[model samples]
Target: MPTLLKKGLALMLCWFVSSDLYALVILQYHHIDTETPFSTSTSPDRFTEHLALIEASGARVVRLEDAITRVAKLETENEIGPGPDAPAGNEAFQVAITFDDAFISIFRTVFPLLKARGWPFTIFVAPDLVETSAQYLTWDHLREMQRAGATIANHSLGHEHLLRLKGRQTDDDWMKRVSDNTREAERQLTMQLGGNRPLLYALPYGEYQPLIIERLHEMGYTIFGQQSGATSRSYETPKVHPRFPMGGPYSALESFRTKLSSRPLPIPHRLLDPLLGHAETRPSLSLHLPQSLTRTHRINCFGPSGALTIEPVGEGQYLIQTPAMLPTGRSRYNCTLKASDGRYYWYSQMWMRKLANNTWWEEP
Candidate 1:
């Protein structure tokens, strides 16, 4: 073989050998404009800075589905997008860019930036909002995006809270209702975009029950939740992934760089405690040190208020306790430890509780 060909083969071998170790850090955005709600908006200027920083970080920007396949171990790389001519992707962490809600700013601003770099992205569209509102993207805009190598996937028909149920509805009744909406939203994408888009769903308001996940899994949909983590092969949920929210002040480049480079904390499948509880309920999160981890002295677990209590039980087990009862609504117990590589291994456990009257609380 020629010298270049020989180098190519060697790189290919390296990719295959280390493929299992790859991690995906998916960045989730809702609106890329300054005018929308700040809680869900990143300024267009900040988004441009984000793109520059992403390029500087040296992380591979991949399509969401392709990243999922690699990190979830769903398919060999050959089955996804890389070819022999493609750079061997084993060394750098992969990042996927996703915009929820199909906002017009994404079409006006984000699409061109991504397209110029030849990077692929996924847009989770809520069909009911599109074309009906001035803020949201239209069907024609979606089709244009699809033609320009973007994925327009399902965010549900109306973007309603799938977990919220009517007073008289059973869980079975709720599932049927939400599932029908999901299916119809997908149908709209197929009809409008004229392609078989992947079955990817983002939970609205970042709320989910175990039953909701079970049903969506049965429906053959891969889920992305509004949470924080570096999704890895060791993720507890194979089909459901967590995404780092990139909106409001959190879109600042400093926080962005930290999360962009963070590693996934090792967690097992099927964590049964507090991922919610009753209002004002204190929840305990128990976990063990990763097998490769040694010297647990630098470990830190943070809660909504401040630093949490981490008690080391016998063996490698430890229990993290919150300092106070979490306020009603959604919260995350984020634990981080500095690894030998100087990057933090991050794990976020979501907790949610309804108001005293059983009404939902708005995110503050």
Candidate 2:
């Protein structure tokens, strides 16, 4: 082989050797406007910069379906499958873009820019909100976007917190309601969009419990939540797959860069529970990592308050406890282990508080 061809082959061999370690980072966005009511809105200008930075970073932007399928396949197979947008020969770090709630701003601002980039994305919409809320995207808008290469999935009927039940609502009734709401959303999306509804489910408010997850699993839905973590082969969940939420303060390009460059830490399933209960804030999160990770001392876990307390339990097992009671709403414990090469291995667990102890879940 010529000198240049020989160099190319050597690089390819290196990629092949390390392909199993590659993970997918999924970035979640909610709105693309400056004045949206929710704190989860990314300004249009910042949204534009996000796309530019993602493109400049040389990360392969993939559809959400492709990411899920690729990660699921990677769990069983050692090789990464060449999905819709992935190149067959290279082991590139993949990033997928997703927007929840189907904001009109997404259609007005985000769609044009992403369409120009020739990129594919997924949008989860609550049909009830779309029907009644003027701020949300209408069925026609979603249909147009879908025709233009966006995949529309189910968020829920009214974006209610699916895990919580009313004060008097029995557990069986709550489960029945949740099931009906999801089926209704899927049915409406299929009716309006003229295709089979995608199995993708973005949990409303990024909150889920074991009961909720079990219900969703029975319905054959692939769940994605707003937790921060990279999805890798070792990341297996028939319940909830995590996507890093990027909105409001998180939309800054620097934070985006750090999140985009992070890798998934192979955490055993024992520590994967959501750990939610009434008035319970500080839950214990224990992780047992493989021995191959030699930087256990350098691993740091952080909550909304700051650095958490990490205690060594045994060989390759550590106990991480939240330093304070997590206030109401959704908060996460984010841990990162810095590698020698400067990349960080990431893991996160989400904690949710019921809206009120007396009545229906409180809205904070």
| Model 1: residue 5 alpha-carbon error in angstroms | 43
TM-score of every model? 0.86, 0.86
**What local distance difference test score does each model get?**
0.75, 0.76
- Residue pairs in clash, model 1: none
- Show the lowest summed lDDT stretch of 10 residues, model 1: 77-86
Candidate 1 deviant stretches above 4 angstroms: 1-20, 74-92, 234-239, 271-280, 294-297, 362-364
> In candidate 2, where is summed lDDT lowest over 10 consecutive residues?
81-90
Error of 2 at 356 (Å): 7.5
Best candidate according to lDDT:
2
